[model samples]
Target chain A: AQSVAQPEDQVNVAEGNPLTVKCTYSVSGNPYLFWYVQYPNRGLQFLLKYITGDNLVKGSYGFEAEFNKSQTSFHLKKPSALVSDSALYFCAVRDRGWPSNTGKLIFGQGTTLQVKP
Target chain B: DAGVTQSPTHLIKTRGQQVTLRCSPKSGHDTVSWYQQALGQGPQFIFQYYEEEERQRGNFPDRFSGHQFPNYSSELNVNALLLGDSALYLCASSPPTGRDTQYFGPGTRLTVL
Candidate 1:
């Protein structure tokens, strides 16, 4: 069973400071990892994805994720955090195989990022 | 240009009542998927519809049902709703090909008393 884990329940960082949200995944085959951000009362916004590409993937809103196969991690990072970046972050893994290619995503327990101004 | 859209932004129903949530896929999108996002948790896949048929489903019960029209619009119906069913219902759309990134719509918040 493929799954994702967000070890941190919450991460607090000061504005303009570098921020990181940790995520690790377990999958049988090659993993398709994704990062999404959710604001209060709003739908999730796609941030970035890693599907057989460069280890460091950049995404919208100045966010990026480093996919490490050896570490089994895809950690989200930003050079400088903004107050608006304070939101819930989710890490998801897609099950890739014959027939199971339903595009179903197994998500991790979200981590709340708090950017203090 | 319109991203995925869901109707009844917020709904309130009793435990035994039934409710229906509607969704319109993004322009040029042909596949629709439904997910449930409970408080403090990530979204869980409920099912996916393509070609007016259910292509995949999650671990939800039969009490949850859905339909996808020819135009790629969809509806999610829940019967005998339980308090545990209260959550944000999100509808996502993606192209038939690639099928990698799914654009999400503003979710419908369902509250069951």
Candidate 2:
């Protein structure tokens, strides 16, 4: 089974400071990892994904994630945090060999990120 | 172009009642997937439909069902609603073939009383 873990339930960062939201995964085969952000009452917005290639993957809204195979982690990062960056973050993983890749997305519980000015 | 869209932004239903949620895929998308998200939790997959057929389903019970139209739009129907069913229902769309990324809709908030 493919699973994702977000150790932090919530993270606080001051505005303009760098922010990092941690994520780790467990999968039998190669993993397809994704990061999504959710605003209150809204569906998730894709941030980035790591399939294969460069360890650092850049994504929308000036966000990026590092894929560390040895650590089994893919943590989201941003150089400067904005107050508007506050939202719920989710880490998801899927098995590369899953027959129906679109059927299910193993999601972490989610992390609430708060950026204070 | 419009992204994924869902109807009935909010709904309230009583136990034992039935409800249907609608979703229109993105302009060029041919597949639709449904997910249920409880407060403070990540979304849970319900099912996926492509070419008017259910290609895959999650671990949900039989009470949860769905349909897809030839045009690629989809509907999720839940029978015998329970309080546990209360949550935000999200719809996502993507192309069935290749490395298409899934795009999501704002979601419909369902409240079972």
The predictions' CA RMSDs to the true structure, in order, are: 1.3, 1.5
Q: What is the interface RMSD of each candidate, in Å?
A: 1.9, 2.0
User: How well does candidate 2 score on lDDT at residue A91?
Assistant: 93
- Candidate number with greatest TM-score: 1
lDDT of 2 by residue, B1-113 (tens): 88889999999999999999999998878878899999888889898887788877888999999999988999999999999999999998876565436778999999999
What is the Cα-based lDDT of residue B7 in candidate 2?
97
True contacts kept of each: 0.52, 0.52
lDDT of 1 by residue, B58-93 (tens): 999999999999999999999999999999999999
Candidate 1: pairs in clash: none
For A47-102, candidate 2 gives per-residue lDDT tens digits of: 98898899999999999999999999999999999999999999988534234435
Instruction: For candidate 1, state the interface root-mean-square deviation in angstroms to 1 decimal.
Output: 1.9
